[model samples]
Target: MGSTILPTGMVFASEQNITENSSYSSSDNVGVSIQKDENGDLMVVKTETKARANVARWGAWQYTHIALSTGVTAGAINTAYSKGIGSVLGIFGLPGWAIGNLLTAAGWTNYGNSPGNAVARLWDKNHNGWVGFYKRTGYDGAGRAVATAYKTE
Candidate 1:
């Protein structure tokens, strides 16, 4: 008698295989897979995605001078000069000149000398002292006054 061989149910099944008792599936998809390990724990696979970038904008400060008479208190100087200058600029849709006056009044420049004095000496005909205005040019790196002008003197 001659021995004979026979092929099983599925010839070359890539995903699943069928046996007489049980069946198994590959459970793998491209690089991703959904499968259980010997411990029967689920596992997931992922691919790298593009990262997002962030951006920021830069701005500059603007300043104007306020002129005042001598012997003016910093507060008074700020009120009279700063407010007036601010109001005038506001009319033209410009930023308040108060910031410049405040900075000058606060002694941020010239050893904290009265901004009023600087303005007065520079432009006041009576030399009675006045407030000065300065605007930042371009992006003020130090955030300080770049140029200054007086109310008329």
Candidate 2:
């Protein structure tokens, strides 16, 4: 068996079993399983899956930044978590300029510094800051399959 990590962040791998003439190869989102069918003919199974996620990290000092930023309180974050970032912003009734300032001060790397981007991210469905979307489709040797996972974490 051998594997390679490509520059595009895709993974490529292959393995072979000489005795049974079976083989396998896969990349970031696709795979092929090659084996002999009952009739001793070569059969290939193709599988594909797609997924996406993102995260950003901040130092403990970020808390200091938020604390020092004007008009933003600890409760602000709590409110966003319990409700949504849009709700929190709505409660403030601040102008767009003020909202931009607030987010810039509190923003993390992956979260945007602008009001619209920040709200969409912080709300992130559950407000835990973890969001994911994925889809899987193709043959898995035994049967064809199609699935989608819109969110997790």
**Number of the top-ranking candidate, with TM-score as the measure:** 2
Per-model C-alpha RMSD: 35.8, 21.1
TM-score of the candidate numbered 2?
A: 0.21
Give the alpha carbon lDDT tens digit for every residue of 1-153 in model 2: 223333332222243342355544435324433433344433233333331211121111111111111224334544443444455555444322233222322232223222344533542434544322212233333443432111111
Question: For candidate 1, lDDT tens digit of each residue in 15-108?
Answer: 2322333322222212222222223322121111121111121223233444334444344333434344333333223222323323222332
What's the lDDT for residue 80 in model 1?
Answer: 34
Per-prediction tally of clashes: 15, 0
Q: How far is 50's C-alpha from truth in model 1 (Å)? A: 28
- Model 1 misplaced regions, further than 4 Å: 1-66, 71-94, 97-128, 139-153
lDDT of 2 at 128: 48
- True-structure lDDT of candidate 2: 0.32
Q: What TM-score would every model get versus the actual structure?
A: 0.21, 0.21
